[model samples]
Target: MAKIMDRLLLLVYSIIGFAVSVVALLLVSRIIPEREAEDWVESLYGTDRLLQGIVITVSVIILLISLRFLYVALRRGNASSPSIDQRTEFGDIRISVETVENLALKAAAKQRGVKDLRARIRIVESGLDIMLRTVVDGETSLPLVTEEIQRAVKEHVEEITGIPVSSVSVFVANIVQTQTFKSRVE
Candidate 1:
């Protein structure tokens, strides 16, 4: 997507350059005397054959260069693994807060002591902020589990989305206890 956007921007600049150059050339031509302009054109063209040849050569060169660049861009697009589209806006490129929250919750759930994880994300001026509530094993130390969950969530969200995580607040809302066969046997 980025490639197309870049190409469009380049095309705009080229058009602007061409317009400016033509305007400047026209202004310079106006400053010269009519007789001098005629003489200059006559000397440059001679029998008119050279002028035609120069025009053809320059046109062919420009066409070839443009085609070469187009070919390279197409080949690169084909070679890419992800196959993303060729144009994207700055707003479209940004990751949403909801996506970050989902990633954070999933990462927290992967921790050893966590039974379940839920997260909420907020977008602040500085960056994204996440609040997580986790269910953990009753036998696990609350502080240790909370710290691990917080770290895991923060790191995973940042890595996946490339968004800076300002704060991760963990709330240990519940403790899960698993029933053991030994208790039943006793």
Candidate 2:
């Protein structure tokens, strides 16, 4: 609910900024005469109860929105990346997705067949879902290589983080050439 409110407020703030910019541009470019702009401002102060109330209410809202922006800007820990937040009896622990990706890459790199690799980790309802995209040596069996990668990544990540791994999916993107050079006899 708080996030939704923040997003809505941000959208309103953006729109207000755009509208103000447009008006300022028009006024500066003489498209809207200086006298007309002055008249619009002076009209707000004229004897009108409902208009004044509305103006006051809008001003208060904008002030609150500005304060919220300031609060967010000044707050610490605002630069955090996406992570898995967990709580235990001792304290709360956060494992960043990038860390998990590195763990997966580490596990996959130990495999003999994997030449180049990439990993992605997703937090699922059950647990973590890992995806590995890899380039393998042409001599290795695709099924065996993929299976090894999936097993190694799942076990290593779970062992290190103590987080349950729901799935580890391996994608065999490409295979590298294995060429043997023959010796020339003169």
Candidate 3:
């Protein structure tokens, strides 16, 4: 809801900014006469005098607006990290999604026979659902490996975040054979 509101606000601002920019360009086009621009270039195109400083003042406002938007964009870009809010007795804590992902990956990796792991987190009504895609050794027991992965991921994520995990779904994507490089000397 808040994100939607923010996007709407940005839309409104962009519309207003586009309108203002158009007006500013139109004003600039009318302000400086091409024929006498060289003579009045030092005096704000001489329109500052004709308009009693309105030209210079408006131009300065536009410049400031452009700078302000640039600063806001930079700030927003830097704040793109995703966080989940947890309510505790003390207050609210924000946890980064990266931390949760790392925990899930680590849990899956701890299981023997797992060669590669991929984890994706989804929010459901219950809390979080962790979906894992795993690559394991060809000789591994599929049932045991998947069961272990599910249990491990669920336990670690719930214990760390204090958030109930609705489910841990494990998909065995591939069974890879171990390969060792051999060197031959002739």
Candidate 4:
């Protein structure tokens, strides 16, 4: 909900900024008359209490939005990537999701018949849920290969990271075809 609101605000802020910039450019370049700009401001200044209140409210909202943009831009790099955080006796241990994905890929690739491999890691309440998408050689048994991949990935990640694995899901995306090339004679 907060992310959605932030995105919506960003979109609104961008549109307003773009419109204001274009208007300023037009005024400076004499495409729009200086008198017209002054007249618009004067009209707003002479408006009723409701109109004045709305103008003030919009100004405050724009100011707040600009400040938010600055804050997000100047924040530290630690918040950039999601990590699995554990509170240890020593202190805290942080493992990046990318690191876990790489571990899963490493373990799965060591198994026979895997032609290509890709991994995704999701941090759940219980532990990590790993998803592996792979392409295997056509000659290999799918069930056996997938099971080995699941077990290997689960054990390897758990042993290395000390984080309990909720599940390992293996998806066989494709099978590599065995192609024979014909000898060419001159």
Give the per-residue lDDT of model 2 (tens digit) for 6-68: 999999988877887998999999999989888877877887778789889877878999999
Best by TM-score: 4
Please report, as a residue range, the 10-residue window in candidate 1 with the lowest summed lDDT.
78-87
Predicted model with the maximum lDDT = 4
- For residue 88, give model 2's deviation from the true position in Å: 7.4
Write one digit per residue (lDDT tens) for candidate 1, span 26-126: 75878656777787578667867777687677667557657756776777453422211222554345455566777898888888888887888877776
In candidate 2, clashing pairs total 0
By TM-score, the better pick of 1 and 4 is 4
CA RMSD of each candidate after superposition: 17.1, 3.5, 7.8, 2.9
lDDT (Cα, tens digit) per residue for candidate 4, span 1-186: 866877988998999888879988998998988898788678788866676887788789899998887887897867657899999899998899999999999999999999899999999989999999999997889999999999999999999999999999999999999898999998
Predictions in order: lDDT: 0.74, 0.91, 0.80, 0.91
Q: Once superposed on the true structure, which residue ranges of model 1 sit more than 4 Å away at CA?
A: 1-92, 183-186
TM-score of each: 0.48, 0.74, 0.56, 0.81
Tens-place lDDT digits, model 3, residues 1-186: 846755665676678688878856866887646655555555664445765477667567666656665766676563746777878899999877777888999999999999998888877789888889989997878999899889999999999888889999998988998888899889
Candidate 2 clashing pairs?
none
